[model samples]
Target: DAGITQSPRHKVTETGTPVTLRCHQTENHRYMYWYRQDPGHGLRLIHYSYGVKDTDKGEVSDGYSVSRSKTEDFLLTLESATSSQTSVYFCAIRSAGGESRNEQYFGPGTRLTVT
Candidate 1:
């Protein structure tokens, strides 16, 4: 099924402002993840959804929120952007079975800059 993408391949944000990034998938898979990548760090999950309206927070959910009302779209909104939020964001989709254990397929990436 291999289909997922992120928008705003690049963004310039202001501190204390709000920004939203969009992730879309055509695979119709049941698992989707939003992660931010930074130097010397792991792909910290911001949030993920297992099904429409079935959402859960992740380890680095602070200052960020997500919504998935449709199967193809996942939106991440930053309530208050900070300099620390400046990083690359990637959207990933994995098949439903753990046995598949497919590596996350990343978007070209959205490079966000907060000033």
Candidate 2:
């Protein structure tokens, strides 16, 4: 499980509605990231955090927001979800230093649909 879990594993919502997805980790990783996977775009980064309350925008962050209040929890929010926002959301964690320093372990993923 990589000590990661995403809430609302499957969700269906209407357009213009606000949605929030949560990612929790038990591995005490120092870095957390949120990404979206689409048919043509593969996986695109939405946001990331290097430490608690320290976050930054990523490649596809226009319609999304993220917050990391604690080392074990990262949250991704869609202010107003659209059909274009429908995709599989993934949460990944990486250690700051170790043998697997560069490796990112991902969660099972959350499937979101905006209709």
Candidate 3:
């Protein structure tokens, strides 16, 4: 939790629908990331933003998209919800200035279930 916040702590939706999860931070970190965790897949980075409107796709970016409009907010959207995408999503932030510069702190997480 710390300074990061995630919206819709729990979500339930049907297949073929769209879903959007939000991440808000109060620490003003420069790096924000989105990750998904499943039973055996562990945690996979879906996308990340280094600055406002500057984002890059990660290894598991096929069905995910991310956007950052300000220093405090990051958004992750699923184009089409699917059973395979049903997992716990987490938002992480890496401080750019301090002793823990590269250390990433994660949010509580959002559990998404697709039926």
Candidate 4:
């Protein structure tokens, strides 16, 4: 919720193909993050952005990339699809200076399958 949305809620792609997922938030928070949820991995960070044009890679970022060009939009790209990358992807936005400051609120999620 919190005005957050992920595009192509579900997708199926072939291995080695490129894929890109979009995350949009109207909350205007200072931080946005991308994570993937898998049966064994639970949740692992893929990438995150603190502000427009500022981002950093996370633990499972070997084949992933991210970009944020504006406050409300962040993009996650899978340079090459892989079966191991098939999982539910989540987008989270940090609350801006509230009782929930630094607390992340997640979007519904995007499910990707690589064959």
Which of the numbered candidates is closest to the native, going by highest lDDT?
2
**Compared with the true structure, what per-residue lDDT tens digits does model 3 show for residues 1-111?**
459999999999999999999999998888999999998899999999999999999889998888898989999999899899999999999876677556889999999
For each of the candidates, the C-alpha root-mean-square deviation to the true structure, in angstroms, is 1.7, 1.5, 1.7, 1.5
**Candidate 4's residue-wise lDDT over 49-85, tens digit each?**
9899999988989989998999999999999999988
- Candidate 4's C-alpha runs over 4 A off are 98-100
Between candidates 2 and 3, the TM-score winner:
2
Error of 4 at 109 (Å): 0.3
Where model 3 places Cα greater than 4 Å from the true spot, the runs are 97-101
Best of the two (1, 4) by TM-score: 4
Model 3 Cα displacement at 8 (Å)? 0.6
lDDT tens digits, residue span 1-115, model 2: 6899999999999999999999999988889999999988999999999999999999999999998888899999999999999999999998666676588889999999999
Cα-based lDDT for every prediction: 0.87, 0.94, 0.92, 0.92
Report the error of model 3 at residue 109, Å: 0.3
Ranking by TM-score: 2, 4, 3, 1
